[model samples]
Structures are given as C-alpha cells and as structure tokens.
Target: MTIEIGWKLDNSYVNNLPELFFTKVNPTPVSSPKMVILNYPLIRYLGLNVQTLQSNEGVAIFAGNKIPEGAMPLAQAYAGHQFGHFTMLGDGRAVLIGEQITPLGERYDIQLKGSGRTPYSRGGDGRAALGPMLREYIISEAMHNFGIPTTRSLAVVTTGESIARETRLPGAILARVASSHLRVGTFQYAAKWGTVEDIRILSDYTIKRHFSYIEDDENPYLSLLKEVIKRQAALIAKWQLIGFIHGVMNTDNMTISGETIDYGPCAFMDTYDPATVFSSIDIHGRYAYGNQPNIAAWNLARFAETLLPLLDENQERGVKLAQDAISDFGKLYHRNWLTGMRAKLGIFNEESEDGSLVEDLLNIMQKYRADYTNTFVALTFEKLEDSSLFSTDEFLKWHRRWKDRLSRQQESNNSSQQLMKNSNPSIIPRNHRVEEALEAAVKQGDYSVLERLLDALSNPYDYSIKQADYSTPPEPSDRPYRTFCGT
Candidate 1:
C-alpha cells in the first residue's frame, strides 16, 4: 500500500539554483525506526494531515527509513570560517528532502538531520545522537515561543541503533523546518571557488526567495547586503536582551534569512555575566553573550565581502560601498538593544538617561551575581522582596533611580508594568532543567520529564505557579553547564 497525504513539495532550491549549489543525495535508511515525538501544532501549520503523519509510514519518513513522494533529497555545499579560520564545509549528516509549500503559500525547507553520511562527510560517521537531536527540538521550540526567529523541529525519531561517541549512544533523526538553509558561508563558497556568474545567479535566486522587495533596486546585491545587516542587527539584539549566548557563531551557522540555525552549543545565561560562554569548544569565549553583536557585525562584513564584485564594477568603489553599509551595524544594533532594554525595564518613553539607567541595573546585577531571568522577573512583577540582593544599598539606590525614571514616562504605571511583563519571560529552558530532561529520556527512556518541561516552556511570558517549578536555577554544588556540537 502506498502512503499519500497530498504533500505540496515545490523544490525551488534544486530547480532554480545552479548545479554547483548542491549535490543530489538520498537519506541512508535506518533500522527499526521509532517515533519519539511529533509536533502536532507544526503539522497543522504546514497544512499536513496530522492523522496520516502520526502513522508508521510517517515515522519512517521522519527517521530517514522511507522517502516521501515529490521529495528530492540533496546535500548542500558551503564553506565557513570556523573560529576565524576558513574551511570548506557542507551538509555532512543532513539531507534537505524538499521545500513544502503550505496552504498559506509560504515555502519551507524540510530537512532530515542525522540522516546519514554525505559527500561532505569528511572522515567520520555522519550520524546524530538521540540526546542532541532532542536538545535542538526543545531549545528551538522554546526560542520560537519567546518570539525569536529560529528554525523549528517538526519531529524526532530514534534509529533503534547505537552509535559510538564518547560512549555508545542511541541514534536519532531530527526533522527540521526552516525558511531556508542559505547561509553566509554559501556565498563564501561561491566567491572563493565558483565563477563570478555563480554569485550573480545565487544573488538573484536569494533575492527572489527571501528579499524580493529589494530586487528592483539599482544595486540589488548591495541592497541585499544592507537588508541582511538590518535583520541580523535586530536578531542579535533580541538574543542579547534575553542573555542568549549562541556559543558558536560560525559563518556557516549564520543564516541568510536571519533565522537562528544550528542549535549546537547554545545556552541561555543564568548569572548576569556578559562574558558567559557554555560551549566546551569555546575556550576563548569568542561567541560570549556580550560579544554576539560584534561577532554578528564581523560575519556581516564577511557576507559583504562576498558581494564586493556585485556592488560595483570598480573594486575600490565596491569596497567603499560595503564598508559604509557595514559601518551602520553598530548604531543599528545599539538602537535595537536600547529599545528592548527600555521595554524590559518598564520604560514606556525614551529618555536621554535611559541607557545609563539600564546599564546601572546591569552593573548591580553583575556585581551581585544575580540570576539574569529572575532579576527581570522580579522587576516585572514587583517581587524584589523575594531576593536578598535587592536589600543591598547599591541595588536599593538603583531601584530608587529606576522608580524616578519610570515616573517621567508618558504611559500609566499599569501600562508600563504590562510592557515589562511582555518583555520579561517567566521561564527559560534552564540549563540544569534541560539536562535533567535529556538524561531521563536518553538514559532511562522516560519522556515524561521532557514532555513536562516542554509544557512549562510553551508559554514563556505567562507567569504562573507551574512555571515556577522549572524556573529554579542550578544548585550551587552542581558542575558548570557545558554544551556540545553533537556532530
């Protein structure tokens, strides 16, 4: 019997782009695949039939054991500056099945991560472990709930096979949906290796897909660069306002669509330390919480480099154009960050002293080693009496100043509080809680913990008694939280 569910797959990527962009490939089959979880909400969003996708055939498709009709699997090619060193990289353990056209007419790339080895698999097993796949699923969904731009997980299925990492771990495949997988590194690869015509074709295709509004500009490529810069600036500001450390902001991981991709070694900060880094590989803290804006600007500069030829016929003029556009990044980022900080602090109107007021609060938080999320939550709900740090003279003085600043706002006190409530999340995917849930699911085969954690994280801004259960920070005796790439 053939399984069919009216899959609306329109493979624009493979059809519209040149052969140099990707290589045709099929997912390597897995044995005895079992569905671990399914995102019913996402299923409906994509206009997929939920009942059909809940069947065994759907599990097989998600596990890379069966291919769906109209799916054209391929491994994309790209290059990246990993830790500031240029290297060619690509989809080693992932295969883009096809672009699914939703009923609303939006197209999304459906990818199977940990599907198997590809031409880009240099010298190792191109497989993903169960824990890491689940981690991405949890974190990505949490990020989405927080109103952040990110790739989303549609499903996760275990391979029923063990792969050796530091130890034998259960294998799994993640069904990831994204606006597109185009990255800054994709342009780098074309610029460094392919013909000039390849870049032009790619630029045109990208503009058509993501930035079509800019296609009519006199210099569409330059416009594309500026638009990317704007999106990335605002995106990084959002991350900073939430204490998110991407941990690994490699050129390959930075998406052209400005959506957060590749959830490797990413974590939200607990303590209010700007220098916090959770990736075990980030020994120098290059992608620290405070450094994300700078790194984003740096990556955009590299992206600008790829468009140098397209910017102008004269190399000097093109460089200048790219430089001028890149220079706006800091101001753009600062404006976004300041506006967000104002909202978080319950300031309803802009004031000259608002930046210093926000900085003073941060300085107190850092000096007292306060929990980042909780401190904001306290201010949002006026629960500062709960924390002893609020009793300190430095904090008390700062609090008085904050109150004075709030009085100058045009909005009412109630409206200002409502703004803060919306800005400050009551719950984040706490590092310790995430680890606990993963341990139970992976080691004990108990998903109840993971399910419950997901439920608590589903509505981050809603402050409820249930959310408080997962809001507690790690115990003092616990080891420092570290994350892996899970590659």
Candidate 2:
C-alpha cells in the first residue's frame, strides 16, 4: 500500500546550498520494519494526519524501507572538534528527508537517525541500536516537556535485523525534528576547507533562516555571531538550571539554533555534584556539569573563528573584534545563569548578594550531597521532610537567610512560590529510572514501563502522586551509572 499523508516537505537546505554543503543519499532499506512508537501529539502539532501515519506503510517510511513523495533524502557535511581534537565528520548514519512545513508555516528539518551509511560513515556500519534510539526518544521528549529548547522525536521504528555492537543488538531508527541541522561545525567545515566566499554564503543563509531580524544590520555576520553567542549562553543556562549535563560538548553537537541535540550520553544530575560525568568515553571529565559554561564559551570561540573574514575587511581588525566578542561570553553566561538562579530561588529582584546567595545554596547542596532536583523542589514547596540534609545547622542558616531575602521582596510569598514552581521542575528523567525503562523495553520487549515513565515525565512542573513515584533518587547501594555514545 502507498503511504500518503500529504507531506509538505521541501529541500530548502540542499536547494539553497552548493554540493559541498551536503550530498544526496537515501536510507538503507530495513528488513521487516515495525512501528515501536509514534508521537501522536507531535504529529498533530505538525498538522499531519495522525490516523494515516499509524499505518504499516508509515512504519516502512520511518524505518527507511520506503521514501515518501516530496522527500529528498540527503546527508549533510560538516567538521567538528571531538574532545578538543579536530576531525572531519558529517552525517554518518543519518539521512535528512527534507524540511517539513507545518500548517502554522514554521519550517523544521525531518531527519532519520540510524537510517544508513553515507560518505561520512567512517568505515562502520551505519545502524543504530534500538535501546539508544528509544533512549533519545524518551529523553528528548522529556527535555521538551521541561520547557527546554530541544529537537522533538516524531517516531521510533524497529528493523527486524540485528546489529553488532558490544553484542548483537536490535536495530532501530529515530525520526528527529529540529529547527535546522546546521551546527557550529558546519561553519568550521566551510571555514577550514571552502573558500572565504563559501563562509559568506553559509553565514548569509544561516542569518536569513534563523537570525532574520539582523539582516538589516550594518555588520550582519558579526551580529549573527553575537546572536548565536547570546542564544547559546541562555540555552546552556537553562540546561544547568535543570541539572542537565550534555555529556559531550563537541562542536558538532551544539546547534546553530541553540536547541539541544545529540542525546548520546546526556543525563540529568541526581545529586548536586559539580564534577558529574556520565559519558563513559569522557575519560577526562572535560564536559562535566560545572565545566559546561566554560566549555560553551570555548565552543563559541571556535564559532567566532569561522566568521573572522566576514567580521571585518582587515584581518587584524577582525581578530580583535572576535576576541572582544568572545571575551563577553563570560559576562553573558554569568548574567543568564544568575537570572535563572534568581528565579529558582524565588527572588523577584536582583541584588549584588544574589549571586553569592545562590552559590551558598549550591555549596550546601554539594557539601551535604543533596539531590539536585528535589532540593529545589523542597525549597519551592516548603517540603522540609529531608531532615537528614535540610535539618543541618549549615543548611538551616542558609534557609533562614533565604527566607529573609524572600521577605524583602515586595511580591507576596504566593507569587514568589509560583515563579519558583515555573522555574524548577519537580521531575527530571532520572538515570536509574531511565535505565530501568530501557532494560525492560530492550531486554524483555515490554514497552509499558517506557510509556508509564513518559507519562510521568509529560508534566514535569506539576507535582502529582504518579510523578512522585519516579522522583526518588537511586539507592546508595546501586552501582554508579555510566552512559555510552551508542556508535
């Protein structure tokens, strides 16, 4: 049967860019594709026909067994610094079907992850394991619910074939939707390899697509750099405010749209530890929770390097301009992070002491090893049940100071609490719970656990009895959790 849901797909990226930016490709056909899960809410949001998309033919399209009309599958080319080591990389196993135009007239890139190998596949089979694909589906949706800018997962479909990883694993594909797949690395690729004019073309296209308002600026490329820096600073602040660790802060993973992408080894911090590292491959702890801000500044510096030619006519003047802009990253990130911290602490007005106040709370959390999410929740809801940590003299002193600070605000306690409620999520995708769900679905082929977990995570800010079940931290006796890149 032909799958026809009237997709409004267009190859805008390929149509606008030269062949150097991307290469045309198709997804490798899978054997016996089956739909594991479909994001009906997201489908409806995109104004797609949900009923038609639930059919078997739709599963084939998702699994790379069939290509739909108006879909021009291709693989994007880019380069990145992985763990500070420069390398030429691109869409090894992913295939961009086309940009989907929603009923509301918004454009989003609809890509197939783990679809197949392309020119960028570095001597490895371009197949994805079912567990990791579903993991991305679960965590990405959870991030979206938490009000973070993130790529949305449309569906996950299983391939009736095994792939060789640590052992034989079930194969799957993830249909990912994003504002655009352009990354900092894309600029890096154009800068290091292509001519100066190439960077100009890519920058102009990016500005028109994302930073359209800046097109009228005298130096639009410089404004583009500043805007990207601002967005990234704000985006990283949101991640840190919610205790999210991106695990791998590679240049390739940082989106030009400032949306969180590449959920390979990303995990939420359970305990308030600055030195948290979950990615097994991150042996040096470079992308730890505390190092995220600094790493973001570093990545932005790399991005700034790619735009030096367009920043100014004189090379020397361009370098100075880039340096000055990069220098502001610290101030930008601190302001954004401090603002978020103020909201989390229920502080309506900012003061000089606010930064130290937030720092003191974090120090107490670190000193007592308090749960990151729950500690904020306790303060937000006045749930002082955790006497083991909250009853200490140090914490009590901090709590009294916090209360005094709140009293000074003109807003009523009710208003402050509401702000805190909006800023701090009561629930995060906890590591142990995520692992349990993946274990059940991957090992036992039971998806009820995953579905229930998703339901609990659907409303992270609103506290409920069902959500409370998954809010508990892992037992102390449990082994330390580690995550893989799933390559």
Q: Put down candidate 2 lDDT per residue, 323-369, tens digits, no spaces.
A: 98888888988998999999998899978899989999899889888
Identify the runs in model 1 with alpha carbons over 4 angstroms from their true place. Answer: 1-4
Candidate 2 TM-score versus the reference: 0.98
Candidate 1 lDDT for residue 113: 96
Error of 1 at 213 (Å): 0.6
Please give the RMSD to the true structure for each candidate, in Å: 1.1, 1.1
lDDT of 2 at 90: 96
State the lDDT at 409 in candidate 1: 69
